[model samples]
Target: MKQSRLMSLVESVANVIVGYGVAVVTQILIFPVFGLHTTLAQNLKMGAIFTIVSIARSFALRRVFEAIRMRSAK
Candidate 1:
């Protein structure tokens, strides 16, 4: 079964949304241990930037793999 492009995008977005929350929380907890202090707003902003990049990377990789799968099915 092949996955549609829309589905791939939706999956990527959902995955990133979960990941973004995790990343922000982890940063809040872990940054102090590493002597890296940032405000909540800063953490949220950083997480948002990384989340955008992650979404793009995830979607691109999914597409690449889907293409490979389709090719090999021939």
Candidate 2:
């Protein structure tokens, strides 16, 4: 129980950090090249989008990690 709670907290923090990173990356690498406005509103919108994407990415990565571990054990 305690271990699960700690794991949950770690996962939550990782998601937020990854979301912010993705948002910043989009702003720097993708937005400017495409001429998208980097205003506060746009940034907020992008951040929200990134938060969702990051969560999905995290879950996908977790699955891949599990798969790799399983394959290595076998």
Candidate 3:
């Protein structure tokens, strides 16, 4: 089944949100293993920065793949 552009965008955004949540949760769980103790606010700040970077990376790669797909389709 093929999805429309809007659907693809929605899926991409949802993926980013899910990925961010998983990453943030993992970071909090593993922070103690690295002997770094942090407050909730601090962890959230760090997570936000990482999430932004991840979103950019994901979007860039998605665009690249989509372009390739378009070229192949034609």
Candidate 4:
């Protein structure tokens, strides 16, 4: 079955929300290993920025793949 645009967006957002948390936590753990230190607020801000970009990329890719699936189905 084909996925609706709204569902695609919802899925992307949900995925990114989980990823945002993971990214922040990972930064907290991993940054020190590389000698990169940042405050909690800074990490959160960076995570938010990356989350927005990730959401956009995920949604766009989903749409592109859906389009391809639709074309191939015809």
Judge candidate 1 against the unseen true structure and give its global Cα lDDT, from 0 to 1.
0.99
Runs with alpha carbons beyond 4 Å of true place in candidate 3: 1-8
Q: Could you give candidate 4's per-residue lDDT for residues 1-74 as a string of tens digits? A: 99999999999999999999999999999999999999999999999999999999999999999999999999
RMSD to the true structure for each prediction, in A, is 0.5, 4.5, 2.1, 0.6
Better of 1 and 3 by lDDT: 1
- Which parts of model 4 are misplaced by more than 4 Å? none
What are the Cα lDDT values of the candidates? Answer: 0.99, 0.68, 0.78, 0.99
In candidate 2, stretches whose alpha carbon ends up further than 4 angstroms from where it belongs are 1-15, 18-34
Model 3 agreement with the true structure over 1-74: per-residue lDDT tens digits: 34556666677778878987887788889998999898878888888898778767776777778778888888
Candidate 3: worst-modelled 10 consecutive residues by lDDT: 1-10
The order of the candidates by TM-score, greatest first, is 1, 4, 3, 2
State the RMSD for candidate 3.
2.1
Better of 3 and 4 by lDDT: 4
How does candidate 2 fare on TM-score?
Answer: 0.54
The residue pairs that clash in candidate 3, if any, are none
